[model samples]
Target: MDTCALFHRYWALASESGYGDDLSGQIRRSHGRRPQHGSTANVYHGTFIPNGLEVAIKTFPSTLSGMGDGSEVLAGLKCIFREVHIWSKLRHENIVPMLGMSKDFECTISVISAWMPMGNAYDYVQNTNNDPRPLLRDIASGLGYLHGHELGPVVHGDLKGLNVLVSSDRRALLTDFGLASMNTSTFNMTVEAIRGGSYQWMAPELLDNCVATTESDVWAFGMTALELFTRAVPFPDCHSVANVVGSLILGRLPPRPTQESTQFRLTSTWWEICTSCWRRDPSRRPTVDEIAERVGRAMYDTAPASFTASSHAYAPTMDTMQSRLSFTGDGPRSAPITDNDNLLPCATLSGLADKILSLSFSPDGTQIASGSANGLICHWDVHRRAQVGPLSRGHQHWVRSVAFSPNGQWIASASYDGTVRTWDVHNGVQIGSSLQGHQGKVFSVAISPTGGGIASGSADKTIGLWDVQAGKQVCALVGHTDKVQSVSASQSRIFVSGSHDKTVRLWDARAREPVGRPFEGHTGMVWSVVFSPDGRQVVSSSQDGCLCVWDVRNSSRVRHRLEGHTDEVTSVAFSPCGRRLVSGSMDSNVFVWDAQSGARVGASLRGNAGWVRCVAFSPDDGRQIISGTEGGSICIWNERIH
Candidate 1:
């Protein structure tokens, strides 16, 4: 129908229904006595003058009618037209049915619906003694109907606790559609108005790029469910909008509530469903139908025991006497392990004089290079599980980072002696003079995928780029306010650096400048950083005992936030297939995680005598994980162990 005809039809219906009476007087005499303010409209309790049937009158803001030109006013009218057209046709039990539209309110137009005495879903759950599972199921059912409409699917751009109202019968009904979109036609609303969603409940994709889809709505549903159960806003720890944006950019979901009463506790199955809805990949999220079915089943079943509590029940003690360890394995490059998999003792290579601080695997995966506190670099054979060559020594202080060349011919080491040097791996001799540019101690170094460029991060708050073939400093990029702790270079010559400033910055080696905004999620100093196999993602470890996986292509989107370590996470490395990650921590534990799901793979690998300082995955097969400890021991684990 045309816009003018639709408006006249609704206006005629309102006139016949006697909606022209003053709503303010009717609201003052009604049960609510005051108007309720929402993001898009103001709702007041009122009554139909003819039959005295109670109803709610929703009026748009008058500012929308006072734009610079008349075009904006016309657009506002068209928006109301579209919303009324869509909302009036919806007939599901969980959907708030539209009664009529009126022009007698303060704004140019108004919408009327059935009066919900129980208020919004958030208030209802907080004030009543009703079971939240039935409300959650009602919400899912309403969303499912909108998405599965036979005419054309509709996307509820805003799905949160505030948008759902509870009826007198305790049924949750979805209300506002100001930000919704219909597949048949587009609304004439401004971009700012359309993107006006609650930031805490928004999906990462929507926060990164302000485009809302059905998948994004699913993400909001998960946050809404969390709000109902916790009786608080999403991400309750975040204090402001900036903090919420930062958390969402880092793919950090709300941590499970620890103090919830037994009546409101979230079961393991329900939490799993919520996490599945918040997956980083939009296609991986479950459909509304699936969510409704899960909630329905959950309502009738007994609450299961906590899965997180049982996963960390056993902690192994340190054992240093074993020289060689073996385990039953499926094969090389087997599927990623699960929490049920058993962890066995692994081979231990000992002989270093002082603390082992750094580790790296050769491209062929046969040889491993490690740097120690006494400035000694040693090479080891994986199969033989012993030292391979004479120790290479030159630095005057502790060696902090080591990386192998692409061809496995040279090893680059960064030291606290304020220099970076390359050593010939085969003969244990220095390749060239030390590359000196930083005024402070160098903490980390990485070789580019092509093996021609080297990036070094130092305590001087600068990153030095060096030419490996020329053995000279190319340029120094300075931006960090604090010390740079770790650096990793990708195949495209682009690199990422984590700093003591508690931020992660991306740099283009060729351009010699920053790429985008610094990733700002970690609350503690960043300790380590590394790029995934495809160079599309970067995983960073921090002193906060957490790991964040970021999408390199878009700095605003973080793929996951891994939280299991009990102490400072010292190092992180991606497997060859990019499906798994290994991290070492000061807690003297090593953990393996599913890179995609951000779920802990199995029990923590224990037995390190002291703090774990470095970790790496085999470059060739990804089956072997090597970790070095402060007590001068290197352990190799087979992740495919049965």
Candidate 2:
């Protein structure tokens, strides 16, 4: 496809995947102004206005390496696809996260990421103080993660001030690795290499065609450190690129920063790190890894490297890394920044535990299990509000139901693809699959109180007993004339199914036959059925606006006509206290009813704009109701109502 078509195709895919709004907003706040005009790659800030996320979008100009403007047409569509392959292999924390790449590299490739709201070190220095020593330590730690992590030694060729992104927590992230190469003139050491960096802060070796070894990077780091502290160009008052070049060739290095009296003292320890960085010999400077260890030993008791080990795997090896630096590889002089302390701070978003689809907390109120659309299930971390997964998969489709075993260790999920899977909630591993021979979707599933196996109701008009581990049909109880919409299992070995049969029937899960009677009450298809927490009562909701609470042992309806739903009630659950019943309906309301009196309690929550897909109470804070909507939003309501 052509570039224009390719761009539209990518936009369509991005919208479908939900990756752009989540990841691209991260890159925008971290980027500074473009280093040079007409550079192949231009960096811009992207703020997610509505989602409250920020990201960076890096665009590669049409003509790469200036191979003659006429050669632009030679770059084919496959060439853009090739760039995607290159970026897809790259993953790191100190490095920027790659969200989704557009189809064409020449268009705009955006990556969403976490924001560093504290602002870049360059801005922090000029705005807060000329000597940003605390900031320098953070910068070292980040580079240490990148270069030392065994993920492959990533040499960020463009390591000047403009590209060193800062995190709000004051940590530094070395970005823009797309410019790096395998240390050759063609790879990175050519004049065209000046495409995306601040020349004033570039090490001389970067301009003079020397390999951008770790040592050369150290020299650039030193110049960046100087700029970070002083808010001044490495060479002050040069006025223009011509004047700076004249001074450099005529034997002038940017004036060394003189020690000054300030709140943050620039002691000999600081001078040692910075001056050694500018050593004329490439072999004379420290690798980013070495610097992080020494500085960390001085500040935090143990190397913070241990903490950031999660960020990059190379942390263990920074202890013995070695590098040779070069100072004379030089390049064209560049103009300095006109705005020193300006910072348009980046935005931040809390990381999600997973790509959540459908979530549910267990009925017991002690544990919560969330079933993901990816065919896995996760239990929530009560303290962190994040998901902790022992995730297991057994279903052929997304999990639709997750009911905790009476003891709370096992959970079952009904699947659209006709299977009921049980899981060991503590380890996130599948314990068993109940593969009943159903001709259609398993619309509802429930576990027996004895914890032996499960009963699954399906569109095939049959509800069956599934041997929990062997994953086979043990018994088939068939009576419904249409799809079995819902099922409820009780401690008395009784399973009740509500269906388009317009009735709720009692089946003995182990006896291979229907129990004493089938209670006919609804005028339309049944939608949901729940065993009352007491096990003696069962509440069933249907397409007809009636909810029936039946006295299980007697096979009689104690309340045949619980009312008030304008539409089918899709979900029903009893509160842990067992005295209150909660039900969610397609009418976009959640109602709580007094279980004994059959009276509605709390007023319906009407804020949901779409059908309430899920309603859950916090295991720790039961009064707080959390609802998930069809529009892809989760809202927590802390209000307590009676």
Candidate 3:
């Protein structure tokens, strides 16, 4: 059908069907003065005469008259023509429905659709407390529908958060088809062009001067996820375009958001899917159907309590929940081990000359290792509550953190001397010359679950993966801008790091690079990060006075931020079952929290007269909790339940 003929037929059909009067008559009655409305391409919100069904009218500017050859103007007209052509055929609930288009060259080339009152998804995240999973699902569904259409696969050249429009019913609709194209092959547009593309969301291949592909669309969807969760542009910290492209080439990603303003935070599964989309190899990117499935699973896993509410109904106020905020205590206080039922003081290792800085129970629970401020790493017999062997004393500076290898044969310790050393726990002898690389204080060390290597994070703003047997620095994972305070290795490939940069970052120790984006929610230095037993989640404590439990497999977002400590949280450890989290603080108390809900389980466990520097759950069965204090005391309390 011809363009003018099709337009006239569409208008006639609308008028006859009571969808307001014909386009020309409506324009005439309104005196050609359509109200300026929300726009993407000169689209104006207007009333349709008597019935007044709200509509958005997208018009092509007539300024093509003054330009020399009018090629620039010609391109815009072509874009409008393409939008109407492509949009008029799409009939999915998640896709914006086109009402009609006008081809009157005298006025302007225009296309019209239903006006979306809620505006873009990016804006919606900022103003609403509504859960965003449904919106993301809708976008993925719409994109999948377009790609799986019987005619041909359609490529949305641009699919950032801004391109997604939110309807009055809160349904997200994929709009702006200016750069879209139907293709039979994989990559559609082969022209080496950066024009009309969102650089921040563009795939690395596209940035490297390739064409738009279905895979590239998937990449943009991942970037859009970052925007929806973070409420900011991709790579918000990277100020220049050059830096963004450079980061992508070097395999860096946007930081995960830590905000609790939303009804549901992004899950670890969601983040895993998102990062997979941004993989450097475009061929490895997931299809739209796969994306939809992943998003569906994430929604099912992390659905909020308010998921069934109406669109207009906002999430309930969290003030009551906020009462459990960390730091709501009455000054500095202490509680005894016997305060709660079944609780007893199992053991106390006293008479140490210097304060204990770190504590770790061996895998078999037969021994406990304590790193002291006196540059000594002592192994104590857990059964007898006595020091067992000579101290592994080679570090010239205070030992900040310590961990026992999975096999319980070696102890890895981080020290202020800027070195990470592994020692034979059996003989209390230093394993080898200090594993040196960091130029500043080594604050934390974690032995891999395989016990083959140790990972250390230091004040030098780097994480070093060292081979324990070989005693050599393998690679330095450099990303954090501030001191790397704590490092925790998962059972397999991943490791998590918390830093003074106020972020928790995921890394692939095997690959020696960041896995996904850094978790960027803490307002103060993140002092500790620990993975759950299954390596599916991460728990981190910060000077910000919040303990954040993050889903590590899906999204790196802070799933729960437990509050109650008024002082800096020094250490956090997950129970063996991963159901509970124990945190020690400078407030001189140890608190336990429900990992899933971020709620306090009971009153704080207290005994230390000074700040609690470290904490560990007994590896045997979590029936006991051990804490190292600044006052040179190690307290072990038997767990009891009523």
Candidate 4:
């Protein structure tokens, strides 16, 4: 369909679905907006609507698919849904996220993501002949983490040029893992159950053994590693590699002519790693950690490698360059607001030996409160862009967490000392009290919307409720079998807690009993959780890097899984309007996303020198953003970029 026709149908269907009435029109201005993208999911980039973001949007089904194609639709949705689930499990620097989804027959799944201005690695290979080493390293690191890290063994069953994204700086990242399988679950999946992967990069065993094993994956990675350097896929030239399936089973070895040069010397170490990985015997393959150890050691021993991705992957041969926010960096930096033209003054808060940790806006917007583990809570006057109050102190340890009460009169700080301390918001004086019932370090804190109490989550696997006014411990809500990483107030009706135990619990503050049932579906520790605007939608973040938005009213995670943020999402806060969300993480950046649209609003918020410990919105002011960093600095980001 043409743009007009698609918009017409979109509006028509949206009206019929009643979502037209609910359209956050915050995105109304983004109507008819489209993403500037390279080839991947075949669809019109222009026909989609912005989900309150600039980089990605949902495409209107002009016609890459069909209606009677119900099976295709169902299968595609399943694949997409599976992609959502799997990607959530693998978060790293080179991997983007795909979180909770929203879909309509007229539109494909929501494209929740930040911008990648340089396009994909394929673009680099097509445009430049420079070496793709940095990206290769990043890809290797990501794949390594997947194949061998803390929660890895994640097999990107389908690794190809198209799935590798290239940043403007030529940094490469892996994308489109719809067919990727977790290493831990590979044994549970049969080849017959899902013969998913790119034919060109398929390991010989995938055809012979017909099972996911270390060797098969290593073989695929070896080929992928080669493909990265050569930019050559097995198709068109190999006549669809599927034709060689039988030969693979017959144990016929393929030739790999080494290109020897000090520059391109496919030496013994290289071959040892590659050949071992591709060895017919899975036992011979080196894990990602092993590869990292050797490669990292080699790099350390040798001269520093240049950003080869720039030389080979990001050559300035692009015929087109398009971006909404004109970036100032020669390379694409994460924070979109960092544009030199839009640069905000640095007078907000400075003179610290650390990064900013948590940022919160006072209800009146007169003060912006920032808390950092530097053992100080700094308050900045909005108009003056200067410190307004004495540095709030007391938590000797890094203030691991902080929250502002709904009334804006109190600020709660969860510390490394395993105590929750209250500070007078205006005076910056300690409340002269602390909640000391927990034996483990406090990890998170939340203020009840009703303004009567506070909820503190600890590493001890318990959540303690306190009467803010009474300044006394109200009750201990316990059930998580492991460390409680996060807690959120979903109105006074329900309180949600997520834990390392791999379960999310919902409790009624009034009834003193569990609500409905535990919302389950994560395979790793749940790290961040928050309530959606209406109080019915609850969003939880996990080590899997997936954010499952749940329907609190019905006690079910919204079918959509929010993915991205290549690290544990340590903190999450709803936008003042609740249509947007901001998440902080160990990755040292913050991501602001449109709740309904799933589009990252700006570049990932940066300038944090260390792990971003917490993120919070100003109670009434939407533009004021406050973030606390591990380095003990608080940054106040006013929505206005220079």
Best by lDDT: 1
Per-residue error for 185 in candidate 2, Å, reads: 56
Task: Please name the candidate that would achieve the greatest TM-score relative to the true structure.
Answer: 1
lDDT of 1 by residue, 517-553 (tens): 9998898889999999898899999988999999887
Q: What is the lDDT, from 0 to 100, of the residue 577 in candidate 4?
A: 79
- In order, the Cα lDDT scores of the candidates are 0.76, 0.56, 0.72, 0.59
Model 4: residues with Cα > 4 Å off, grouped in runs: 1-352, 597-602, 608-611, 630-642
In TM-score terms, candidate 3 sits at: 0.46
Q: What does candidate 2's lDDT look like per residue over 507-599, in tens digits?
A: 877677898677777776787777765677788776676677788777655564679877666666665556766666656566667788888
Counting clashing residue pairs in each candidate, in order, gives: 0, 31, 13, 31
Query: In model 2, which range of ten residues has the least summed lDDT?
Result: 340-349
Off by over 4 Å in 1: 1-352
TM-score pick, better of 1 and 3? 1
TM-scores for all predictions? 0.47, 0.43, 0.46, 0.45
- Model 1: lowest-lDDT 10 consecutive positions: 343-352
Give one digit per residue, the lDDT tens place, for model 3 in 496-516: 999877899999987888987
- Cα deviation of 318 in candidate 2 (Å)? 49
